[model samples]
Target chain A: MDICKRRLMKELSTAEKGLPSGLTLVSANDLTSWYIDITVDSNSLYQGQIYRLMFMYSPNYPMKVPNVQFVPDENRPIPIHPHIYANGHICLDILGDGWTPVQNTVSVCLSIQSMLAGNHTNERPPDNDSYVRSAPKYAQDSRFIYHDDSV
Target chain B: MPETETYHSETIYPVIASDIAMQGTKTIDSLNRLVDYSSLDYIDVPGHLLCPICQYPFVNPYTTKCGHTFCKECLIQALEPNVDLSVECRCPIDRRPLNRDYVEDIFPAPKIISNMVNDLVAYCPNKSRGCQFQDQRWLLQRHIKDVCDYALISCGGIKEDGSVCSQPTHRKFIMEERRIQRDYLLYGYSMLPPTNARLMYGSSNIHTKNNIKDSASSSESVETKDKSNSLKFDQPSKNNLHLNAIKDTKLYQKLASQDDMPLLELQEDIQIPCVHQESDCANGCGIKITKATKEAHNNIGCTKVMLSCEYCELQVAKPKLNLHFEQCPEMTISCSAKAYGCTWIGIRRDLEAEHQSKCHFIAMVPFLSKQDKKIELLEKENKSLRYHLDNISQSLANLPSFGNINRNDSVSSDSTTYSIETTESLGALPVLPVDLSMTNASISHMLMENDRLRADLDHLTTSLAELEMKQNTLFMQENFRNQEVMHSIKGMINTLRQQIHYILLEHRAFTTNSSNPVHIINQSSKVASTNPELLRRRLSDITRQDVKL
Candidate 1:
């Protein structure tokens, strides 16, 4: 088996057994893709809203960061924050150049959960409309300038 | 079932013997095997044993200078992408700089840590394949290699089409086939007639004879034997004779086939050779041999084996022996002066003796050797002197005044020493150099003293700046307090002036009321009318007042 599949199997088993609060593994179905639902449990601007996170893993996963985005669907929508765009692409440093191999699906989910929970602004990025119209399909391809640390 | 029973009886002996033999000689190719540790069922592995980068148990652990441990492979992969970029690689856990100066800041993990990680208990990696073996993590590899029957291995046989067999087989089936093949090769037979085989066949024969006797003794016995035979064979027999004939044929076949079973079994053995006779010598000897002769071949017969050179005592492989001889320092060679009519020849070790005695170039040899030694010694002294000169120059740059004073003092002392040398005996001239060396030592000592004083001055200057900042804040606070005091005193003076003005206005009103003469006169007449003594006293007081005025 490829290392990506082997690592995914371990992570899948761990996720199936249990996940931390506010994170639900909706469907994995295969090794290459997975879906998780994240909810902000704290009393923040996104407290009552839930967001669906889609993780697409490449063959060089863990060495290469997985592509994670808030997949807007029925009953779950993209979170509104100063760093999160309308198209659900987040500008978190860990999701971009700041990613390290030590992070996994569970850690990513918890980070997104905390990112939503810590947000106070109920709006998208300042250039949300223009960026969302021209953004790439995968968030990993975008070169986001991580100028904000207050999110 | 009957066919299987007969086959098991024939193959059982050699199978047991080969199984026992294989236990001692089992070897697994563990070098290229990649173990997936995440799939293993660990018995509570400690967190410290896991690599923080991969979140798995450490494989080939290495420790960094920052006191963090990571898997060697994980660290390499983490550093690999940054190799092309100019950025320095850092420890994944703590982000401490790792590849500084292009040197990795990591070392092999401590022995205790390696041992502890190896000692952790884990189930076999092939547990999902129905293997139940469990042991310490280090032993798990050996189990998979030597014992785990469910481990997947190639068939390791070529097909009739002249291509290697690519079918995957379980280790259990492969090992059984190897055992059978080894037993056939060593014994030259499929079945071994051990004493135990005869005992097993003898017991069955006795049971058949008892059935024949019981059937002849009574009709009830005949019915019971027929029922038992029916259950055993799943077919009803009419009488004891029929069942007895079936038993006779089974025994006869077992004995007869022991000598000439079939060509099919022989062909299978030929297709797969003995495990001992598998591969060629790994040392590149190019001769294939059985495992029994492998040790001997590697020890002595393999020409590619490493051996120590007899002349130089340097280790060189057998194939490289001639190459080593060309550069061997101890190799014997004729003297270099042979062309000059010198016939001396010997090993290089004794070449010095030849040059010292019989060589025609002897005179030049000693002179050249002496000059070489002298030049080497002079170079070493020159290096030391240059290092001292640089140090003195650096100190002079730091304190120019000190250097100037020391130079003047040394010049004056040198002049005094010269004057004394001229007056005294010639022996005192030798002491002049010693006095200059003493002055040189003192100059270095004074330079060290100057450095210490400079450090002290820097420390005091920083403390003084801190005190000055504190005093400025204190003065500003006092000035603010004085301004508040002055504002309150000015308001107090303004309130006093207003109070004096109000008193002056009240005194003027009283004087104006006293200056109303007509009202005063009426009031005096009213007083005189009320009392005659008041009028007489008023007239005498008025006359006295008029005289005083």
Candidate 2:
């Protein structure tokens, strides 16, 4: 097995054992992609709303960070945050340049959850309309400027 | 008893070893030579022993200056220059600045840490391949190299062209080859003339020769005692020769000295046939190769060696297998009209002609998909509408005046009464106060409460149905009684009319018979006055008859 797959399997087993409340592993049928359903805690501004996070792992995972993005379905929607675009592209450092091999699927989910929780305003990015119209299908393909640390 | 057992085993080991050696070159794939750590099943290794990067017990552990340990390979990969050179190398765990160029920053982990990780117990990587060996992590590599029957090793046989046989075989096969060479060398020395054997093997050869002669004489006597035992006697003599030869050449000493030596050094000129000479290909290719050309046969020549299509079971060469999959007849393919909401899925053969031509989704693509989207939207709207309507109705029913109006408008007034009674009964049922906080115990309690409430509702519904049925029967009975009363009244009116007709006829006859008109008038008046009482009696009798009928 490839090292990426092995590491993913380890992370998957640990996640399945238990996760912090509001984060759930929906499906991980293969090592390449996983679906996790995340619910913002009651204290958050977007309370009672659920969103899905889709993780696409390359064979070079850990060395290269997995592509993490929101997937909007009938029940789940892209969260309305200043750092989150309408196209489900998120501007988070850990998901981009700040990624480390130590941060696994669980930690990534928690970070996104906290990002949503810390926000007081329910709004999209300033360029949400324009960016959404021209954004790449994969969030990792587009370069994100991490300008805000307050969120 | 122990001594005899030892002697028996001592004689037996060599014979079996030689027999295995004579079987010759068996080939195995050397691709999976290294023990894969990720695949090993570790037994409860502590968290501290595990590498922070790979999250597995350390393999080639290295300690950084920050007092953190990681797998050497993981550290190297982590420190590798990024696509963007501006991003400096850093520790994966702490994000501390790391320099890949400086060797002093990271060094090999201490021996204790290495030993601790090595001491961790793990099952053989070949456990799936039927190797049951389980031991310390350090011993696993040696086990795979020296002892594992499933482990692949070089055949170590020389071809006629003076090339070393590159064919891989199991360790057992190589061990056997060494034993066969040992046996042949020993047997030749034992057959040598006494002076020649003495010169070749020195004084040690003389001692072994004496032992072999003694064993040979004892075996011959045993053979003569029973001709039937000759087959068994022959085995001991061969064992004696093997043992004597091994002792004379000091092969046993070499084997005993180095436990890790997988195969002993032997003369390079020995020719051995391929172990798989007459054996059928493991991939079920029926053709048999007669020489040590297994690598060529399996790698390129054999068509069945590679995987076949999981769907169609079509066996093709590995390079073209992926291409075959694109057009495999049995491969599952979706209809081209999938975008138009056609969910038809079948084999490639069917989808190519049958499903595509007949698909209604293709013909009505534009209109149908748009309608489908509209329908889906409408369905969502309809669902919300139904939910709102249910809420409105529930709220309206909660109002007393509205409930009364509903009861009045509905024909079944009894149903309203029954519903009121049911509500009263439901109110009488014990209501378990639910705790808002969800704990394990409270959740179970709530589940039980839900079950009890459902049972109460079920009982109430069944009883309500019964009451409704009774009310229907009562209404039907009331209607029958009203119809019977109306029929009886009609019969009484008809009898009264008949009585009036009879009285009029009598009066008419009397008037006609009388000659004086004034007397007739007076008579008629008297008769009129008397006739009423008689008519009244007759009216009562007729009513009685009607009542009896």
Candidate 3:
């Protein structure tokens, strides 16, 4: 196994024993891709909803950041906010330009859950319709101007 | 998983023989990668054993200023800045910031921790090839060099510019070879020692065996006597006796008689045969050919030799040659229609004419395009030449007028004019006289040039003003477009805010009393559905009244 796979195996074993409340690993069979579910344990928007996150890793994981995005399905609708588009593409700065290698799949999931929990208004992004028309499949590939920190 | 504490002593040095047997002769690239410490039988490895970045046991462990330990390589990788200059590195366990200064404050892990890591025993990576060796991590290199059978040693006699030849041989063979070389150098004799003499020098046991055999027998034989003398020759204390015996020999006298002979001439007389004839001759002809003759034989007479075809790799014999060029399959000849620009390659007999006839680009289009490109380049050159000619003629016309005007000045003695013969209608123009009158003409010419310059400046300023005005209007139009976009954005934001406010108010009212709120919302929705347009108008009126208030 490569370094990334070994690290994921250690993480998997640890997470199996116990993880923080409201954070769980949905599936992580291969080193290149993993899925996680996160829910904010507070009285705020997206309080009860379990948001599924997809993390795609390159062979250079732990040295290079992985691509984290909200995976929408029939059961899990995209959390509506100013930074999240209707098509489930997020515009968070840390998921793109502000990413650091020390961050892992769990950290990214927690950051996104907090971002959704802090929202006061539940609505698609301001230019959701127009942006969704031409959004890249991976949120990391999209060039987003992240000037707001309040989500 | 069994608890490691159960087998604390055994775990330190686990039964690695079977594990080494399974790996079988594979070279270890990294010792840490070879051994999975997490699964070892030793005392339970703590969480700190694994690097936070790679999740492997910490290699070259370093402690940061934040009291967190990590592999040195992993720490460097974490602190690497992304595209932006600001580094976003921090301790993974605690979110304390780490920078270059913080890293410089790093120190090696405590000695006890490092000793525990180093004490983990591992089998030799080459145990499968019959290496029965195991050692602690730090002593592995010494074991491999001193006792391992598979370690390679360089062939060490011939030196080319002080660099020993590095062709590796087995350790046992290289040791034997080095012993032979040392014995040969010490003897100061010819390199090719007699077979019996070599056996005597190979080991001291053989000499003792010969002495014991002689003693067991009743006779003190001559060969036994010579063997005893050879033993004395090897000893340093009896060296003078051997030296005196060597001087008294007839072989020494013969060598002394040849002292007058030039060494160079003697070296030339003993010529070594070419090594190629013995090695390269496959037929075993046993012909002792000299170096000069071997060169000729290699060029012509060697029938086992083969010559490769220039077009392909087909080898043909020089002595029993065949018609290789005519019959070889891969021979590449030029296209028959190469003049037509069909740049195709294959066996010319196979493809040249066939491809040329079907190639459309080669037919007429390429020729036409080639001519068009030439015409374009020629037209560009013609335009440039015309421009240069116009400039030259204008300068020539101004030259003589300036010369005549300067001739009347105090510096006229230094001004010389070359007679330019312009055999054209321009020769009929009036010429200015070289006198006080020419100075007046010069002044007027300067005045007219000044007027032309002033007019050019005026034209440029007007153009600049017009450009500024156009730019100002463009900026104004851009501002208007931006304002329109902003207005639409503001309206969208206002609607979203109102929707959010309504949802919050509904959640509050619904949560307070679910019974009456649901029935009331249902009745309100039924009334709005009956007359949707009227309901929308009333809602707008309410928003307008709110805004007025």
Across all candidates, the chain A TM-score values are 0.96, 0.96, 0.89
Q: Count the backbone clashes (under 3 Å) in each candidate.
A: 0, 3, 0
Per-residue lDDT of candidate 2, residues A34-67 (tens digit):
9999988654567767799999998888888899
lDDT, candidate 3, residue B76? 66
Model 1 deviation from the true structure expressed as Cα RMSD, one decimal place: 30.9
Candidate 3 displacement at residue B30 in angstroms: 7.2
In candidate 1, stretches whose alpha carbon ends up further than 4 angstroms from where it belongs are B1-39, B82-88, B100-104, B151-549
Task: Give stretches of model 2 more than 4 Å off.
Answer: A16-18, B1-33, B36-39, B156-167, B173-273, B279-549
Which 10-residue window in model 3 chain B sums to the lowest lDDT?
A: B267-276
Model 2 agreement with the true structure over B1-549: per-residue lDDT tens digits: 213423211111111111222324322332333455545799889999887667888877888877789888777788888777978888887888887678787888899988898788999777776688999876776677547765655664433333445666555555554554343334432231121111122212332323433332332233222332332234456446545765534555654566544333332323332343244554566777533344568777776766778898877776568789888999998876888678988998998778868988788887877898888866765654444344334433432242225323442234334434433433333323232122223433433354455556667888999999999999999989998888777877776566566657556656664655666666567767877687558646856587667
Say which prediction, candidate 1 or candidate 2, comes out ahead on DockQ.
Answer: 2
DockQ in order: 0.12, 0.24, 0.19
Give candidate 3 regions above 4 Å deviation.
A16-19, A40-44, A143-151, B1-43, B65-67, B81-113, B116-549
**What lDDT score goes with residue B524 in model 1?**
52
Better of 1 and 2 by lDDT: 2
- Please give the interface root mean square deviation for model 1, in Å: 13.4
Q: Please give me the DockQ of candidate 3 compared with the native complex.
A: 0.19
For model 3, give the interface RMSD.
15.0
Judge the docking of candidate 2 as incorrect, acceptable, medium or high. Answer: acceptable
List, residue by residue over B1-549, the lDDT tens digit for candidate 3: 124323211112222321333334433222212343333332334666766786656656777787877766666666665577655666655656677355365667777766766676666645654566776654555455444554443333222122233444334433333333233223423243221223322232212222433322221122233454464455554444434544554433444566543221221121111121122243233444432244466566776568887766777865544577766656775454465565767874465447657766557766767887888866765554443344333433333333234323433222212112221222233333343234334433543454455556667888999999999999999999999778666666676687686667657667644767777577557756886786467457544454444
Candidate 2 CA-lDDT value: 0.65
